[model samples]
Target: GEEAARAAGAGDLNVLIGYDLRFWRELSALVGNPYLSDFFHRLRVQSWMCAVPHLRRAGDLRGRLWSGHCDLVEALAHRDGRAAHAIIAEYNADSLGLIERLAGERSG
Candidate 1:
């Protein structure tokens, strides 16, 4: 999370978010189930794709996800599974909402 904050502070949003993807990929690797690991990898890629179009047009909002990442990292670092899950769920919901809003604006 500190790495991400540094990247963001350096004005490289791509690197900032890419750190998140890398973190998830590393985490997914820890899953003993190969199938679930593969699923998480795919989902991470999809999430990255979902952000691409908006990244160019709405980079300002990228900071919104940053704090969530910090909270998520703290939860995971403390081994608080429940808190981590809740934080991740909230992050996903926010991401989905942002994507939907961007899609609507593009279509309408």
Candidate 2:
């Protein structure tokens, strides 16, 4: 994830995509359920792909993304699984909201 942020910071979209894919893979592996993990992995990738154009148009998101991830990591580092889960849920909800808003802007 840090690598992805670095790539984005450097304005290297190609590298950023690669790093993002890797980050999702690593993230899914932590799910502890193969089927469920793969499902989420694919979903995240699809969501990311769909949001790319809109997100790019919205301008740089590295700071926002990095901060979200940092909060998640901080929760995990403290071994607070509940907090970590909440953070993940919040992050996902925020991302989905942004995607929906972007889609709306494009269509309307």
Put down candidate 2 lDDT per residue, 1-108, tens digits, no spaces: 667767755655557777877776777787688898788778868867876777777665554342254556677779898998998788678767767776787788
The prediction achieving the highest lDDT against the true structure is 1
Off by over 4 Å in 2: 5-15, 60-67
TM-score to native of every candidate shown? 0.71, 0.66
Per-residue CA lDDT of model 1 for 31-63, tens digit only, reads 777788889888878877867767667656545
Whole-model lDDT per candidate: 0.71, 0.69
Clashes per model (N, Cα, C within 3 A): 0, 0
